[model samples]
Target: MNIKLLSGSVALALTIGVGAVPSGASEKPNVVLMLADNVGYGDIGAYGGGAMRGMPTPVLDQLAAEGLQLTQFLVEPGCTPSRAALMTGRYSVRSGLGTIILGGLPNTLQEEEFTLGEMFKSVGYSTAIVGKWHLGFEEQSWPTRQGFDEYRVGVIETSESTLYRPNMERARIDEATILEAVPHIYESDGQGNLTPVREYTLEYRRQIESDIADAAVNYIARQAAAETPFFLYIGWTHTHYPSLTAPEFTGKSTHRYGDAMMELDHRTGQVLQAIEDAGIEDNTIVLWMSDNGASPDAAPWPDKGGSNGPFRGELGDPTEGSIRTVGMIRWPEKIKPGKTNEMVAIHDILPTLASIVGADLPDDRPYDGVDQSAFLLGQQDMSKREHLLTHVNNKVAALRWRHFRIYPKAYRGSFSNPSQEGLLGVQVEKNGGPDIFNIEMDPREEYSISGDNAWVVAQWLRFVAEYNESLREHPNPPGVTLTDPDFGK
Candidate 1:
């Protein structure tokens, strides 16, 4: 079953064919949701990034060209909000993930809200999530209780945890802990408990320990024959700040990021292969998108060479770079195979998938996300969501309506990274001050001008106050804004 390449084309030929469906056509397609951490837009081949100045991802490009490559996809300005949106299909502030999730804080994604994993599993799809999950860490909100049949990876401390072997470099890329030879550990009982079961040092090592790809393949191999369909949400912690590389991938590209990108591509190919090998490729929907923009675009490391391509803002800044990043979906049986300029928000995935599986969401909860099922099916004219909201923990907020991105005047900077691409950025500064930039027409925010647009900015500020008021009404509201004693005085 060799995939015959043309006379001259790709070096490693791949046979893309799926003939196994477990005799269940009405059982809904198996879904694989792949999420990237802190990856920029132009790093991949499918996005018109030339190899000269960009990384080459043939496998990813092939996936986009053969599926749905969303050009205007947007997410939260940081990892937590972006993840929260992907899981609940709700805005970050509404779900209490407007800021990064760390520092042993009890505040996490509320258990009351339904996650995509939980939603799909309830409707009979065997669900599993592997890789970085910054949404929550406590038992109440762990992946096991959230509907995953199998959870392989730590629920918390992944951003801080790194591995080599026993008595190796206690040097951590994020947060350091004393341990040994821990590569891929599995958490059973719903992330309540964990144990180490496997370790690979060669071909599989790069995909497993560093990429979160092998566990995904294992899940597919084990369930490819099951009578029930499956939903696998595979998240990878690659290209994120404090970037580490597998030994083999260290010098794989011009920059450290290139090696990471190549490693990600191999992982992508593996997941696709798992589906194809199981003969479920034609019957599965693969949703892939980055969480946010990039870190330097948002925080302390602005010199990291992370670019938002043509995006104005970087990450937490409310500019296009901050919110808009990579998004694409592949489904042979559902979505149209091509590219789309149709603007879509990051919060639209939840209800859309729920419809496909015929699942019911909580009746009492109000979700700000609109179901873009029609848009997915090639019927473009489906919605009129006037504006998309951009929220920073306390620094700033805005209403994004089409080309006009208006913001509140006299607003402090955001606690989230300045850019939305998911790069780590400095938090709020004590010299916390007011600054303004026309995000679309002027992105760098170099020229601060709250003077000329004072009137319009004032109106936007009033709207932000009202938005904050609504958040306060929630059971778990966001942190207060205008921290100093200067708000009311």
Candidate 2:
């Protein structure tokens, strides 16, 4: 069992022939979904980014080289909403999560729903979530309750805190270089509550990175040894805030962010190598997508840099630059290495993965995500997903169906902060989009189409009506308590 890492191109060719195999080929291919928080579409080598010139992201680059690069990918304009959609394959609004969830926010994702981890676990795959668990800080909605058999990361604020603690949650300081110092850690039941985890500075954070990697590798090897197939979701916590990395990768990328990403790249290689070592590389499908658009001030203090390429927006916007990102799928046995401009959203992954694994998705609950199993497996001529929807910021909503996009004149921020603006530089009037353009040509979304484009205007109104109707279908907000869960009363 040696590393069978294929360049994106070579892997694609090997997988094209795998499409005709009967469904559930080689058992459920191990699923390793790795997401970098707020990473832009152009941050990786395959995306033509220059900042990572010497960063040497062989792992991620190889993934793109051997797999299918989904160019027209979409996500929530912000983290919570996008992650909510990803975890459940339903729009965040449908799940009662509108925007970012602070530590104390009530109404965590309901445990009653079928989570992505749960679905995979149900289908005889071992599921684990390591890294940001932003879904619900409440233990009831925590990874353990949400279907993950094992987890090694902290809750929501866990991400924004610090990246290099022994437990990977607390901050530590070395006597001299602030090098990989491990600090005391705490555990939470997912809610804001907390308890001690480990002693401070006892374990270096760098060791934890290797530990997480080791856990994954061991999981794969164990599954293989036991003659059982498995699913491993390696949610990396790098390329994120407090951008820290293994000392080996420091200065490797030249800049702070580059170094952080460089470590991320190298760590990714380790995980892939483990998968191959387990001899499941060819049958495993590794899905890589960013949780949201690029964040501002990624490094050098007040200045942030995430190469969004030609896209002209950042996180927290409804614009293409904000919601659109890079998505890569590498299944050596099922897909060919090539690029597709299919308009995809994170929601689409649930159905695609579930169907591929022969798992049944619940029909009782609505899945806003489209099942593009055919597209991902390279069996279909194109995509079955014609449109994508977005709802981030406060309460603003949008639609991306066919060539049209619609936004209404009125929508409040989350109930608590009604007057807050949801998006920047864009205005919603009785007349939506004073400026709109084809997403292909106007990725900037800077052109106004309200007065000139008749068809788009009509489409806009139609979408708005549909959205309003959907809103009515949802329970109306409760009186006076805008921030609580009762708003959906």
In model 1, the worst 10-residue window by lDDT is: 9-18
TM-score of each: 0.77, 0.80
Expressed as tens digits, the lDDT of each residue in 106-141 for candidate 1 is 458777878888888777888888876776666667
What lDDT would each prediction earn against the true structure? 0.64, 0.63
Q: What's the CA RMSD for each of the models?
A: 10.1, 8.5
Give the clash count for model 1. Answer: 27
Off by over 4 Å in 2: 1-26, 50-54, 155-158, 163-196, 199-209, 297-303, 403-406, 409-434, 467-489
Q: What is the lDDT of residue 9 in candidate 2?
A: 8
